[model samples]
Target: MQNKLRIIGGAWRSRNITFSDAPGLRPTPARVRETLFNWLHYDIAGKTCLDLYAGSGALGFEAASRGAKSVVLVESNAQVCLSLKNNVAMLSAQQISIAQTEVSRFLAATAQGFDVVFIDPPFTKDLVPTTCLTLENNGWLNPHAKIYIETERSLTLSGLPANWQVLKHKTAGEVAYQLFERG
Candidate 1:
């Protein structure tokens, strides 16, 4: 199925972005994007952000639309990365960049720091905790950076940075999402 998501707020508000029917590619729902942006309003402007496992680029594009200075969207799949690049070009989104690499490799190779990070790996992969730990250990997060995590409700986050604290959490059907702040 061809899937699409709309930007819920900021300059790209209401703009539709299309994606392929790639397996494991689930965009964040509109309601969830709205709520996520609300939580990020105070910190989003002019901040750098990372969207790890950026399957559909929904969260990364949303961050760019809402005034983030820059956004890096990392995805392992080449087709998905191509789609993301196409969307960026279509929108003339100079602030957004695409990284076509596996999340682990990208995290290991980059020393870039972000004020905000979005971690939404494929739900069945159990990547949340390990990705979180890598972000912390690899120095990808700036001081007090905000991290947004989306996972299957059945999965438990057992390996996060010790200093990180959950600032918000909610469930939408089988999806469980949380926002964290590193202290």
Candidate 2:
């Protein structure tokens, strides 16, 4: 199966990008994206971004379209990676790069720091907090970097870094979304 996710704002506003129907590949809803970008209003332009679990590439593409200097999308599934590539080509986005690897592996190998990091792992796995720790310990985020996390509403965030502060948080249906700043 195939589906489309629209870029809600920025240069690519109103554009629709296709994605594969891979399992656990839920794209962030338009309302959520709008809210997230609003929270990140002035910080996105010319900043480097990391989408830990690219999935439908909605968030990464939106960042690129919004004037991010560069956006790295990391996805473990091959099918989803291909879909991401297709979207990149379709959008002619020069600021986006795709990494066909797991979040842990990519973080372990890369020492680059990003100004913004999006962490939306599959709901079945408890990877958000662990990934957050890895990003902190591995130096993958610049000081005061913004990290966006999405998970089940019932999950506890006890595993996240001590210095991280929730700048914004909201709930939609069964999902909980938050934007944190590393202090």
Candidate 3:
């Protein structure tokens, strides 16, 4: 059976969003997503968001439901991208865009900038720091944009972008969330 997930808040609260427990994919817990939106407050409204390593497009979908002006989800896996595309269609999110590409490739190719960027790379590899750096280096992140990063509790991010500052951080079980604001 497929796992049905609900949108945490905004216009689509309690609506079901489909997800799969497949290899190389892990959706952030609902509680964590809620905390994230809470931290963002009214910033989620009308902001463009980039969902890197968008497993189920859960984060981007939530942003859309919460009034994000646009959501761009980048995923390489064909199956996962299909699911993301389908879910966006089901939600009737006109501002949601799906890109079927590896996160690294998308990072290099993307010209679109976002007001908020969500990165939740696979925990098996230490990709978060490098990916964040790549985005910052490539100008994929707009100045003063907010970036939400999720990682295993013990993972350390060294040498972050000089302009980004940690605005808040919280831990939930094995997961740790960090919110950064670009200066």
The whole-model lDDT of each prediction reads 0.90, 0.92, 0.87
> Which candidate leads in TM-score?
2
Off by over 4 Å in 2: none
Candidate 1 matches the true fold with a TM-score of 0.97
Clash pairs, model 2 backbone: none
Better of 1 and 2 by TM-score: 2
Q: How accurate is candidate 2 locally (lDDT)?
A: 0.92
Q: What are the per-residue Cα lDDT tens digits for candidate 3 across 5-110?
A: 8898989989988866668687889999999999998788989999999997788999999999999998888877777777888878889998888888888884
- Candidate 2: tens digits of C-alpha lDDT, residues 64-123: 989999999999999999999999998899899999998888988959999999999989
What's each prediction's TM-score?
Answer: 0.97, 0.98, 0.96
Ranking by TM-score: 2, 1, 3
Could you tell me which 10 consecutive residues in candidate 3 have the lowest summed lDDT? 17-26
Higher-TM-score candidate of 2 and 3: 2
lDDT of 1: 0.90
Best by lDDT: 2
Error of 2 at 87 (Å): 0.5
Per-residue lDDT of candidate 1, residues 37-64 (tens digit): 9988899999999999898899999999
